[model samples]
Target: MYASLVRSTVALAALCVAYPIQTQASDPAHESHHGKLGTVHFEVACNEAAQREFNLAMAYYHSFVMEQMKAPLERTLQADGSCGMAHWATALASLDNPFGWPGNVSAKTLADGAELMERARKTGLKTQRERDLVDALAVFFKDTEKLNHAARAKALEAALQDVAARYPDDSEATILYSLVLSANFNPADKQYGNQLKAAKQLEAVFAKEPDHPGVTHYLIHSYDYPPLAAHGLEAARRYSKIAPAAAHAQHMPSHIFTRVGAWAESVASNTASANADGGKTWNSPHAYDYMVYAYLQMGQDRAAHLVRDGALSNPTPPDHFAAAFSYASMPARLALERGDWAAAAKLPLTPAAGAYPWAKYPQAEANNAYARALGAAALRDAEGVSAELARLQALRDRATELKLGYWVEQIGIQTDVVRGFSAARSGDVKAGIAALQAAAAREDASEKHAVTPGPLLPAREVLAKVLLDSGDAAGALREFEAVLSKEPNRLRGMAGAALAAERRDDAAKARDYTGKIARQTARADGGVDGTQLARLSVTR
Candidate 1:
């Protein structure tokens, strides 16, 4: 009997070690110098809710709910007596950012996030963190009034201050506070205190939870935006090393790696993702998207191998249209990059819906990506791209009818750019510039309210080409100035600007721009004439 009891006891201990009731760490009290216990968790949730990756971040949030069952409700409340972390996790998933994935936030994402937060608050949240988060949320969700940047910042700051007061040493609260501040940083200030603060908080959190995938991924992303070269690249590399199989691990990191000019590291990260976790789990399209984009970055074919073609076509899950649409359009994008218009045919204007219910999803990332992809791929053939343009034109009409200014304006920018390109190709220089100007106008209108403006780059590039073709050197200069102001390294734009300057007899400036473009693109040796411009350049 004694021997049997000992064996059973050993088995129980092994099970506990394998998977604890919550986290393996022994801090049941979750103490800080001042706060009671879980106050910081609530604050963390609030901060996370405002992030661009809130959808992906929320998947890992469910673990908090499972952990809460092990501890008493009272024990979970912290310095301000906020409820456990789960409430805040759900809440965070619910709030929408003013600017969202790429540049703009959709009404649907915002509504969903707001509704989720409101549900928790109404449920009589049992802690101070919950109350505080709710109060902050209330100010954020004011009905379609002014999209007041200042007001939102103030509310988030107050929540952070309240949470940080008693839990100064709490890593979660600190990280959340820093993220809120960083998101609001204005580059014109010449001081990046908030960005630095977020970076510091991320450093501290990663030290404690080095293996925490979310912390690692987000830390790398935070680094990519800042100008810090060494530290940011190192962090990006570290993040790739840890979460080698994250859904977007493959190509997304390229944005970071290329930003730092770490092409080798970027190539390695993409290769690692392709070789190791190409299809780790079935139906996770992001995995395939990452793999394909990574492969393309290394100059490999962009086709994803599934036993059945198109089975994994839409890699984006329903809740994450931004990623899914990006991945879904990769095949078509690759075809265009390699100048294979036939191959790009798969991404039609009216793209066939994927296996997922993305049409019902928020942000319409898939819809817009598919629409834009059509225009991008068909740029070489005016007639071919026209069918796609018509589709977008119809969508814009619908959006206008529905009073969806954001979508109407956005799609209009795309249509006008395409029209400008088409007009230039058809020997209508005057009409082309007019269309380009229209596109530019829409772009300017879109920027005022957009957080992640998608079509801006393409529009500017197209407009610059038209201005140069029309012998409008000054206009071309203004267009290139706008693009270079934001992205100074625009390869084609620089070349076009140089061409324009050369025509206007600004020999030195022309030489400088031309040299930069030639070095950037080895094949940029030819001069720009109406005929060469029409044939070599894409209309859309």
Candidate 2:
């Protein structure tokens, strides 16, 4: 395995050297500070100027930098008023965060997309390929008032699949089809049939167009899960280099990095992403959230704290769900990951309450409440836990009202953790253990949403700690090992396992776990002073 990884790394490095990170545009009209967003040959029956801008827009679209594509798309229309495909691309961009939950897209955005599609049709498509592309997008915007988002999404996916099937040589169609496949993937399907199918299509595109930004970007998304993350490493390594200017491209690689427990790589990827946006775009805070997770996993609490502080300090952070999520999560993660119960309990519900529409984002709001509940339970503050539980219940109710089934489930899991911990603190150890086991089972059964790096704290990790505290060393070790198997090299998991092994008098296993923690924290600032690892004595 080690040899294979090394060989893969070497080959990827060679590819990078061959392609280089930066590519200069041949046309002065195509020149912009956005850097090279990968090569795209989207054939259009427009003027040369429109064609250049349209290709650039397609490149941006492929990278999932939807906002950036707008300017180029507008430029394409400005260059040629009859550019029907440019209008089609504009309509597609309106479906922002295509992987997001149903109804997340605003009515205004949907109406705008419908208008753009009408404009495309009015302008007259020159080719069957162009018409097919426009028509596929039309299915998504068609009858938005009657068709729910999920129904439209499935229809769009089928439409795109048909388009790809008709045009076997069309890389753009194949890439877009793969993306829809990923977006419409059923998380409950443990077989991961859709994701696997998407990955296979993307892999074929990747072979033909190695530097195509969309192919690499969607490949990472397709293989984002634990079972498939290793297969995404090549794409992850190449994506940032392919589209260095795209903040999403810079950050997207960390999805695989986080899944594989490549903490240092995850930190670097998110850091570059954050710097690319400079805290102006939602991507900055999103990247910061990932940074906090990666830093915590590496035992770099001080760095994680700095990232949290920096993200929170952004005065005009984008007023969107992604930014709000990061604002709520970064501080909570910083407090909770280090087991700082007091800090976690004191964390404010919304850092900048008036900055964003907090009411619209019940899921984001639930993060602080969830953290506070866990912290209160850990601190043995039954009343505080109960108070936070009420807040979580209210948020869960709001999520249910919004028909956000995923957030409802997530909030339920948080509530369960708090109740279990509170029960244990109140002298019902058996009940607490049973509650935690149920929570862990539920958590294990489902996949986390793309918005989070992981849960604020994984349920199994909480269960492991509770078991350890209750003197079930063997049980604790088992749970910790389970967590590490799925989320390898987590500092807290390694520390918990080491301590549990120590308690069980398994010195060899204890030493092994401790050594992993020491290596992970070797470059950490101020060392692991307040972390669980502080309890273990690791001899170098």
Question: How high a TM-score does candidate 2 get?
Answer: 0.91
lDDT per residue for candidate 2 within 1-540, as digits (tens), equals 644553454344223222223423344354643456778878898999888888888887887678877788888888988889988988777777777756367878888888888899888688999989988988888887788777888999999999999999988889899999998887677788999999999899889888888888888888888788899999999999988877799999999999999988997798778766656678878888898888777666656776677677655668778888988998898878778888999998656676668888899999999999988897889889989999999999998887777779989998998899789867899999999999988888788777888888889988888888889999999998998877888777888888899999999999898787777776555423533443431110
Tell how far residue 24 is off in model 2, in angstroms.
Answer: 14
The residue-level lDDT of candidate 2 at 428 comes to 94
**Candidate 1 residue-wise lDDT, 106-218, digit = tens:** 45645665675665565446556546655655554555356643565557666775665556666555655655655555433335565566677778877775654445444
lDDT assessment of candidate 2: 0.81
By TM-score, who's the top model here?
Answer: 2
Q: Using lDDT as the measure, which candidate wins?
A: 2
Tell me the deviation in Å of residue 533 in model 2: 3.9
Error of 1 at 402 (Å): 8.6
lDDT of 1: 0.46
Please report, as a residue range, the 10-residue window in candidate 2 with the lowest summed lDDT.
12-21
